[model samples]
Target: MTQTLTVRRSAFTVALTLPVLATALLALPPGTAAAAAPASGSAIEWGPCAGMSGLDPRQQCGTVPVPLDHADPSGPRIDLAVSRIASGKPAARRGTLLIIPGGPGNAGLHEPSRRGRQLPQSVRDAYDVVSFDPRGTGRSAPVSCGLAHEDLAMERLRPWPAADGSIDANTATARRLADACQAGDTAVLRTMSTRNEARDIDRLRQALGERKLSAWGVSYGTYAGAVYAQMFPHRTDRWVLDSNDDPDPARVARGWLANYAVGVEDSFPDFADFAADPGNPDRLAARPGDVRPLFLALAARLDREPIPWPGANPAQLNGNVLRQTLLDSLYTKQRFPALARLIAAARDGGPLPAPNTPPDEAMQNTVAASLATICNDVDAWSGEGQAVYEKDVADSRARHPLTAGMPVNVMPCAFWDLGPSEPATRITPHGPSNVLMIQNERDVATPLAGARELRDALGDRARMVVVDSVGHAAYVDNGNACGDAKVTRFLLTGERPARDVYCAA
Candidate 1:
């Protein structure tokens, strides 16, 4: 079976000891249709959440309605699945703290409860932690392209080109996915841009009766949070964007996708060190310098002679699949062993491991929502021909073989049938100066360079903490004590670093 990319980035969390709030009723009125719209001043009738086991019993689930198209206020409306864990001590309560999840498609509905567990007592006591599923995600009117199970595979969705650096198959996949999304549901799909999500957030704040919202947004959520700050500056309180993204309006998602090249290169040395450590049980190489070459050679060999594996996507282990696995595993240190095991097994011609397969319907929704957002967030790529993409991919492959030219490869956005409803929102220093950024020095998703770009764009409005750690995100997960301390302090007391500072790993 061909291994498919099934690794999804995780939400960052800390291991702080905080008081758990008492069990409370779920919010939002009964008979609320999944797509029901709420009035601006309408209060969510608090009620028991169903289906989420191990979640805090006090975590309440509700829905907020926002205009499907913000322009047509009185037109069609869509529901946003929301959850909240109110501050335990109202006497010390400050205000609302929104916990934005990563991924354009990742559901934030349970993030508040999950992440809230890691917050310091003071921080948890200071504000209500809340999160929501964006317009076309999860319980918020979930949408799918009705795509085939194979089409929904992460390997297929991520556009890993042919081994020869040819984008012919990639281009075809892009067109197929794009066409499927466009032909499926125009209303929800076309409305799944970042701008709309940000607007939906504001509507949520209003429904909660909060004048301003403080937020901790991670990964792609950082971009959404920045957009929210830019669009509704007065509505923002203390904002912390961890593992930031480049807010270059000209290249939104495209820039992020491209940064994977630099990101992987920047973080590969860390992986090399691990792979070469003699103490490591699954070390892939005897010397640190040999790891990269070994990985590249292994991938090339697989490209030439794909190993047959039953039960996995495509039923074979090809080079790009291995590359995808490597890229996904690089997201965190804990995931290193998975990649090492694969490399060690492959080196011995051992049996391939069983692949992780997420529910097809879930991936269908995720990929569809992700594509819709990226394609509609900005005017990034054009419907260029395969030759153009092939040349670009070939050049990138030569320049950065670690990524196998996948970073610059064509994706559904290139052949997207829809365009942004408006130009991408430009993030500026014009917002509140309460923004604080925490980033890892070696992030495989959003690199340090991109975080610097965002810091530069935010100007005096933001200050960044560069953690000397390796991996994605900085606060809580994949970050050191110094970094986590600084972020927690800022979240609790609004005391940001006097100037940009570095936290040694």
Candidate 2:
């Protein structure tokens, strides 16, 4: 779930790399006044959302105040920006359906307007769709590490190993990024963790006056939703976790990053099929079997003799850049063409496509928040040093050449200044049986293996609908009609499969 700074049509655009250490929440900085608390039970004074042109006209924006540290409710506070598109049919409305976004860093306040519009009519009529910017993202008391533009590039941010498989530069970069975060806004950044996000969701629930909440969480949102259901089991109604993560509390984000090795192996075949199809405008090979070797050879060649691409990030089409592109492209089949075209250009000496780097300021904000949440979520990764990471990278590269050692390489977390405030929350099968999970069989970000781990963790409290599809999200995005129908039915009628089911592609 590495954030792509490039603009794309999908909601799954947040990056996921790096880490931060957790420690006791920093004391309020000297002379900085704590934010005033909001009056209890005050309703959001909804109004036109600024800077969100092209948003659904019905979508209204507001903010809710929550403690900067949930552990100290009366201490300092920050506002969480929230948005809602009320039920299309108020009389038919059942309750609020929260849309938890992915990335841990992704701002979800606009999801109600974007993804909400894609909901089936029955769902739109049945609930007031709501979303929010998690504590340190978007307009919700946003934070930045003021990262240098060069460091913010995806190639650097994702920790791709040196062309020769050495992690020396990656290790150095990790330390530098960690130091930047330590020096910049440590107070607010330390508060960014999955546990606090769940707490913030509850605070948002209270502000919206919902006694209970039904939700649809995608990608990283799935993990956050699972945590919320665990923390406030009674407050959950119908819950849907799409594109789930492995809730191995001990590994947490570290496990998630390492999972990319398996995820890419599982997803690459789909891309191969797309690239080898004769009907595809950007076909890479005549036979599906040839695509893998061709890509490997081309990447290897690029590693040795990189192409100079003037406008692209890093200003070159090198092997790691190509590998990063493939990883990003595997998120969905719709992105397959882009990957194919890049390969064609690289192999044929054609012009490279323009790079889609996001604004430097936005990249800084997202990278900072992503690092904070993952690092602070668990301390499992804290003690690993250069040797440990080198071994991991070497092993990963040997087994999964497509992702190389990027997934297992060191991140900012290894050098973080703080430590986790509390132990990571272990998701267990003790919650209400309102949970339903829909997962793509070959999601490159949150693969089926991790989803199955979450399913096993949830036990009978959850039922899974595995779609024989490819891509990151399952429901209504990359899933087939069969999968979509099943998920929509559950959200609209609270009916789940009697046992785990599979929908054909």
Candidate 3:
């Protein structure tokens, strides 16, 4: 999973939402009108998943039925698919921990199974780890915009401007996508956002019979978890916000989109280093200095004349494709080979290999959810005049040649006709002082800079652990034993740094 730099970026999606980590359970808040949740059964029921199957008798999965509207519980109800890995040490178990995944589009329903092996045993023994797909996502009732095949392509969906820096195409795409979503089954799509997700979490809490929930929220999920804690402080417990994002109350998703430029700058060097490594089978350069020029020249060539790639989703190596590729490759160290291969193939005057395309069903659900959350979070139509964005897009193309004009261009939100379903919930500092933030020094999607904003917003309620790393999401992507140890230690016990801790690179 990558940081969707978006245009629904692939490969570069790994900002937070890592495998597992620790954080102690917390007690709920007092002197507040926190509503009591619904009645829930006491046990987890087992089932099979793509990960470790029935062999792990402790793991169970089921659909936790919830109302489409919590205000009207008797109204139309939808089911949220869920998975739980019950406490291995029942005697030592304290409570439940919710695994909040990043990506407004990303779902964590499979996490308990996918990451059951990664959790430290003490953390595992103490809590029944649970994760779920938010509404309009996996196993839950999903929304589809009925976009055309070409419209589903990453570049088009993300509103990457024309190579000439013209937004005429972007405007058209916005209209088309907006019309498609509005004309299709949009009831669910219209209602999706971080605010609703917070409501949904509360319902899940009631359904699970847990008095309080300890959470491990990553990337986009960190924002969601923060909003949840603010709205229902009494229900939250020891929370871990790893690889955090900006809580720019006004431009939540837009801020997320703009972070791509810094993200690329922060990460491209890693790609360059990997491309220059001596033994790399697909080394693009023998020295780090040569990698940037090589990528830039290749991208410019592709922009003027795209490489033919029939059968691929977008079917060409145009400027945005190159830009999109650059964003995707920055998420992980292992992806250096991919950037090198793409550059080599394009430079050799040959057809670039087909890029990965998720199944139509998966892509549709992802796009729909991504759009819904962004649109519903805040009005993205920056009405500050397209001049700034257009000029910025051009400047971005010149500055960050790898991303072309995608990061700074107009998006569907710019031309959207709808207002938010609800205002973004404010992340108040008046909650439990149980938040532990772990972030990498350089993150492409949710950069460390944004994490600091989140840390500041939380004030005294959270502790910071900045790992001297260059990738997005630290716990898993950083591969730093020191950073990993700090998080695992805090989660197993209620221990925390007396002040902000920074791990050496």
Give each model's clash number: 10, 10, 8
What TM-score does each of the candidates earn?
0.90, 0.91, 0.88
Give one digit per residue, the lDDT tens place, for model 3 in 65-126.
77776556799988887888888676778777789978898877777766656777888887
RMSD to true structure for each model, in Å: 9.9, 9.3, 7.4
- After superposition, the stretches of candidate 3 with alpha carbons farther than 4 Å from their true spots are 1-58, 350-354, 382-385
Best by TM-score: 2
Per-residue lDDT tens digits of candidate 1, residues 233-337?
767777899999999999899999999999999988988999999999999889999999999999999999998867777667888888888888889988888
Task: Write down the worst ten-residue block by lDDT for model 3.
Answer: 1-10
* lDDT for each candidate structure: 0.80, 0.84, 0.74
lDDT of candidate 3 vs native? 0.74
Query: Which residue runs of candidate 2 sit more than 4 Å off their true CA positions?
Result: 1-42
Q: After superposition, how far is residue 161 of candidate 2 from its true place, in Å?
A: 0.6
Least accurate stretch of 10 residues (summed lDDT) in model 1? 28-37
Model 3, clash count? 8
